[model samples]
Target: MFADVSGPSFIFWPVGCGDTTTVVVSDTEVVQIDINDKLMADEEGNEHIPIVDELVAKLPQRDGKPYLSCFILTHPDLDHCRGFADLLERVMIGEIWHTPRIFREYEDEKNLSDDAIAFRKEAHRRAERCIEEGGDPGAGDRVRIIGYSELFEPGERYEGFPTNQFYTRPGNAITVLDGADVSDRLHAFIHAPFKDGLADDRNETSLAMRLIIGSEGNTLRGLFLGDLSYPTLMQIFEQTHAHENNSMLEWNVLLSPHHCSKKAMYEDGLLQQDVMDEFADSQLSPGYIVASSNEFPHANSAGDNPPHRKARNRYEEIVNDAFLCTGEVSTPEQVQPIIVSITANGIELDIKDYKLSESAEATLTAAIAKARGNSAPPAYKVGFGAE
Candidate 1:
């Protein structure tokens, strides 16, 4: 079904102030990058969207199983891997991309969140089981070590586990799924979580990458940064420039690290002028700076965690009107997913909603009208919860 579609798309789900991106490589193969499905009770708990349901529905089937080519956990933060163990129970993951520092529970286990611990445990079980059986394993059973931090030396891996792996440290590169085409629509380039910048914080160990999507001669690049800090991002930019790896740095779509956290853009309260200048210098004509969090920071209020106003200004200053926040577009009440399709010409927000029962022709028509950015209120249904 996806084969008919002309280009690759990224459907960023609305999960409050958290992140859950569905990278649709093709109609069939898919990747779920970070998940946050905190349960909500009508009485006491805040209303939260159950994203796993949507992820399972979107994945292409393989031998009757809901098949996800990969499930990448950028880092071990709670917002990144909240319902990961639960998602594993639902679908078959191809391979997991992560770093070793995620396993380190420092300072009496204060470094790792409960969700991170759960995800790490699940990763070990699957990788170990696959090795003991002495055969090729499913996606969930596979773990690809993207980068290592200061806590680990080169070639050091999970404790007591000689499982299958694809270790691509910072400054190195890895093909998407070992050059295994999800649908001939896209490929990936790993970038961050370098050995030199490894610190006790998990955000600094974020596994950043660039998703280059499209056919030959029409590819578009989407840079994905997972909660990377300010100084580290600056360092990465400088290093990439020095090595002449400019292609990896260019972005048609940049997911502002840490959900537009000021900490990633500002030193203390002062804006990093050099960083902002560099960002301004690296636009790919049709670029978009997407903040994957609840309503982006407004000019007035100063927030603690992320979605900071100062960070939003940085993106807005660089990308102009192309800046869009997942929460702002989706709004806070409903938590709608933002689908941006990358075509040969450029990237545009997908007008056609991901309705299971919609006619293809009708969906296409709606998508076109919506792309114009002046369509009336969406009348289509969004069936998101109830997993």
Candidate 2:
């Protein structure tokens, strides 16, 4: 994703029209948030993106396995969890940070999207396996249920089990869980998927996380609002003020919510000043805005908030520094991820020539050898012949 970020970096994958972000927290701990991996091919049998392969190759590995400190599902949308099954089978996940909605659906046998169902199965399996064993479930077996939902009432889902034992709520500043620190460099503020905010639209249930990269006076803040709508964003702004949580609002790099959706910024084809005021108020000087979508500044596109043409322009105006999109930054041939990192002055996109380092190459080889010896399978490709 990045050209070997020695420090901290957030890699926004260039997967068309979807979201898959890998926060390279450090050399050791890496957190993958959401995944949008759909197989697409051309008449010439050329595949667009071999997402799993790229992820496996790009993500750091140790010993004989590719490892992820945490795999956070912002929300169980198909775009977010499409390749999760393969990821679980392949990568060594330390722990999972997921909302309670998915588990609730799994327990109730509700009509869930196919991808959601797949993730639910794995999450349940891992959780059950952890519960059977003693103490904390190491790595892959561990789970952290983020945000307590009314869906999981007493004698309800996973009845008789202490579900709240692992439930982390909004405003929680989580660093370490299950004997593993998800990030050493970033201070994550869980801002959304609030208990009261849960409604019908899955988008509103998105787990919004604001990441701060420094401490004290010198800090680089970034917010990841997962598919939240305009009203929700307003609510976050209002609550942040009401509670006097300055850290939650201040961000040098703001990942444009809902893929530069007007619904996150505009209302009824008009820019909401109240919300824009929030952006203007909290945005640090020399701010950077990154939209994880394709063909940004899509003025004509409608229905969905993603790639809203006006939204992109609005973000550009709001930041007044750098406003970039995943699709527009990288070339179509070999779509490299958009890497935003903390800089000396402020946050900037760490766009560089990304090639596997010699160390990383060795790790890959070792992982391959180990997997081969164990007769373990690699992560599956999104499409045929992509690998």
Candidate 3:
């Protein structure tokens, strides 16, 4: 029993770094950008988090057919694709959109740890299964990597395919998925890691997307910057400015890039005068800036986990309203996962109001507290094995 919503959009769950962002477009289609750690009960009566499990649980149950329409992997990073293999087996995927980079063989994947290797093997096995099942693996089930240039052709019509195409090239050097009308509404826009040069690894080539739903009349816009660094983000801004005024494209909601790491906004590994001013200005563009990080006041040895006190102060000074972190900002000790729901109208995110389960809530809380003091946060829970 969910409310009937129109205009096609809504983010189902916005868990911090550890969890995945399941974007449900309308009620009919489901698209997951990345699958982090999956929380579940494992064998031996132990609680094992299998990255994809947590994500699937959040999704509404599908009848008999696979409910998942697509799986978009930003890059080949383990944290990004770890859960993809398991997900493919459990659900019926219409298409799999990814970059051109793929593993040469199973040995090449051996470079990863033992656990990492297992995940990679599973992904390959499932991919093979899709082939044996007679589901068009090339463009039908498995699609090759696509860049922005592929979709954007100066004056020519792209012949954009809505569903049948399954996977398509990134448009305008970007990939944007606006939800279709249904029970669960979600919209996403891919932004960063602009292809300036080709590289062997895909992390530098991660496909970042900005997701939001609420503003249709151009009054408000929510934005999410996924695991993107400052140089990459600035590159996008520069390119956009070259085409048109910065005001032409702006967001009302923003997900702090790179978990709001100081490195994201700093130069020479230090926050600089000009960079600070630019970031402050960017914060003003959106009505709200949502930080998706377990790191609170200070998690790293450098000091704070996400933003240092000084930087947070700078954000407050410019934005006037103050920045919002995922966990409780009031106390450094108290920690809990905060799920945010956004729309064109406004944002509704409160830690206390919602409850998933006691244990689930406890795990999130403990992780946040532990990450705040540790120099390095826990490793990301996603993985993408050899192709």
Candidate 4:
């Protein structure tokens, strides 16, 4: 279902309160960023989609095995890397992109989830292989370290790793994926986990990137800022401005950072005006903001974690009706992915192809009627016109 896209597309899976985005770069190249596949979703009586299984069924194959060109881990958070081991066992991943945070040992390392540990083991194995092979190391053994730190210097943990060929420092653009040049269609600009921000805080060390798809005037920009808070975001905007690279902040589609946490735009019990201003200035026309979280409540209580109602309200002001929450956008019966197709003309949401089931159509009609303060369903059907 995914590989059939006529051109490039971005597929955001509905993995509640986490992130799992697949970038279909071409018919043969695919890049997946983060994963939150829950095995419990497959248990009897559960209706949640087994996302990894769904992905395996549609991914293009290489030598009779499902193939993924690149797997990017935004951070070592459990939610972000939950299915790395499973994916590794099931799919043939060509390369991996990760921050240096995974290499450092922390006191809380013992508390890490099994999947996070699995990812670290695999990432370390690839890095070691790159060191042994001197450079490139060919596809499956390739690893692109995004961000700089003392750990990568000579005589350090990654001492022999070939930085010249496999490293990408912050504020740089990467045009190559797994050994192929996809500059004509796709390129990603690394934007975060700045040298100073790579501290003990895992959230602060999240890898942020702006992925540009299509060419020149017809390009669609997507900002995937993983879990960064207001201070780091402000730093990014200021640095981009100082370097006259404000274009790096432009975005047509933005995956709302940190699952719609208020921290992304708020600090000290108040909204940071400068950060919000930068977001407003950089947004392209017809912008779309997606929240990869559970459905937001009407209001949030004190100390309540993300998917915050207040944060959702702020994002709604930015994109209005275009603000979508993964938990609420799909049919009531099943969660469907949010697909945005990129073409020579531009980008368009590809939800029109969905043929709503009878129950789904009824649910939509009833919801619309309720919103309109009516007791009966509207005479006209809404949403893709019920087939």
Candidate 5:
């Protein structure tokens, strides 16, 4: 049980691909991330949004006050930033964190991403609406859209948002990670392609972070690396080792990169036997690794080869007990939004009423029990059967 004292509640909503992630650190501090498309009612009384909409709808309303403290748009990708325009109309945003790419002065005559192009158009339209209504265009003092590239550098202090001063740029470039204190509980650290690399204008620039969930001074950790590729992952391994005293290979839970795409593991193609072996041996084990992908037989059906197969092969080679896309965890739609709750006692995940195969459930149960303790079953596993 959580004490009445202020603490954080980690809830990951199911928008798969890209959606909102809410973090409630007690009654006063609430943070909502990347609100995608809004809910729309069809003629026959059908709603268009997914399960995450239901969760957002349940957020308690306050008396005409802003309940949200932060809104982070990791990148300008349509899947990631689609709902930001509409969301600004409903929620009170304290700080807007984004990459300078949103307002970058790119001189290339070639058009940027069509998705980003469309989002920019909508952003302008929304800004016009806000101005017409005599509302604050800047969204008040707290509502500033600052780029991550603006002030983030190794050894530099991120002091703009005093509340979240728990960030540091530990390398020579623009990479952000949790300060010593933040890493102590929610161990979310950015380990990846540095600022110099992000300037190359490649998907490798995708924000790479590791989230460790455990109580202060506890032995539990969970790492989430968002859509990172092999080159980037290798760079992270090197940088983290040079910066911190620990190894990057150490993590309790890992979310597979690029939805388990083989390209993430291989540069040229899967047929390259040398690349395959290197990836196969690089796998980390005795921990929970999740692939947030659809239940398709192949990774990319249209591609010459797929990474899904290579990912599975690599897992089999390294972590024999790792979780693969099978039964419930196999299908993205069937995969439940994972909710990680942490307290002084230990850590637990509330797998929303998801359909879990006996083996998958057993693996998860054992992993949790082994990492935390042998107490009663977690609240999320109440009625779930391992058989």
Candidate 6:
């Protein structure tokens, strides 16, 4: 079962304070959400995995070249879109999904990372082709613009670009990807970048969504909220409930927003219990929350960046022991990507026996001996390398 699963799977790479997820929709179809392929990770002493190579090796091929069915950029942040240009050059991407933030950056003359600039250029090219071809410009030139911005107005850059074919607003559901009908096995409900919040903040304009995958009778739901904060999350919760679309908020797996930043649940130095309550309410039994960040500190200092211990504590309360961190799960000797596979029964982790480092092994041995009145420790299996 570890090596073979009949249904779709989600692979979250350990990129250290970044996000890189691959959704294997099927043997022939796949979608990648964000990327942070650090080239320095390939250095001899670096523990990070060279994700681009790993991804290329696993991706399905078309016309004798690596092919990605769709690539979704949640936002233009460097951590989210880093190495995108390299990926684009090496792989044949069928389509791209993005928000208007990329274009807005150019209008504001904000300095963008090279990858972000490349993405913007590619997105603009596809949008132009979409307009020129009238609709559904076929793979490699197809673009799906999520959320609204003035840039997409009828007489603006997106003029005549067939809004119905290319645009998916917040509160809508998308059943097609790159012109392929995935309604039978996949559905993504748009949930953020609300029309009113498309200001200068890139993080606020992130394309958050609830992705449901599997057969109609049995499915796995994952909520991928980019880097949104408390205010927007509160809005999403209230809006979803008001529209009688609470099902869109349900999830078996949730990628903790903003790499487990406290901002997602904190406002003015206070924990927003309503947000926590909503998450606890929406989670299915045996739920899992994955934080794609570096190993969290025991406690965060004032103004410290994310992977915050306080935020992790709250998420732990929601999922109990099912909360996992990509960084903590990976070892120096082995770069373990968290793999959650869908099976005939449901989703399950592809657990592998992790060899503990010498120091870790010694520490565990001492702990076990102390617990047993200083007796020798017995041999034991470590699941997911958890202590």
Question: What lDDT does the true structure give each of the candidates?
Answer: 0.66, 0.69, 0.46, 0.78, 0.44, 0.79
Cα RMSD, each candidate: 8.3, 6.8, 7.8, 9.1, 12.8, 9.7
lDDT of 5 by residue, 270-371 (tens): 443443343344343435555544343644454632236666666555553455432233233344445545556554445545443444344434444453
- Rank order by TM-score, top first? 6, 4, 2, 1, 3, 5
lDDT of 3 by residue, 1-387 (tens): 111222233332333343244444545555666554533221212122333444444444557534566676665555455556567666666555554344332356445633345444544443454436444443224442344433323442222322232333332322333222321233444454455524524445666554444334433344544555556656666665686645423555555554556655666666555544554555434355555444355434564445455445544555634466653331233323333444455444434433334444556555545555664634533334322
Highest lDDT, which number? 6
The digit string of per-residue lDDT tens for model 6 on 1-387 reads 111335688778777788898887877888999997652232122334556666565577989988899999998777888778878988889999998777764543245567777888899899999989999889899999898877666678777887887888999999998788899988999998998887746678889999988777778889999998998988999999999999999998899999999999998899899999999999986589999998889999999988999999999887943898988887556656787777876678763553333433344344444545633433322211011
Tens digit of per-residue lDDT, candidate 4, span 20-97 = 899888788889999977422221122233567766777899999889999999987767887778889999999999
TM per candidate comes to 0.80, 0.82, 0.64, 0.87, 0.60, 0.87
Candidate 5 local lDDT, residue 298:
40
- What are the runs in model 5 whose C-alpha is more than 4 Å off? 1-12, 23-52, 60-66, 105-188, 218-220, 247-249, 270-286, 298-307, 316-336, 343-345, 352-387
Clashing pairs in model 6, backbone N/Cα/C closer than 3 A: none
lDDT per residue, candidate 2, 173-273, as tens digits?
A: 77774465445456878888777766547788888988876434555677889888888888888777778786677777788887777888777877787
Cα lDDT of model 1 by residue, 274-307, tens digit = 8877777776877788887766545646546677
Off by over 4 Å in 1: 1-6, 39-48, 106-114, 129-138, 149-165, 176-184, 300-303, 332-335, 344-346, 351-387
TM-score of 2: 0.82
- Report clashes for each candidate as comma-separated counts: 4, 5, 33, 0, 3, 0
Global CA lDDT computed for model 5: 0.44
Please give the distance, in angstroms, between residue 164's alpha carbon in candidate 3 and its true position after superposition. Answer: 12
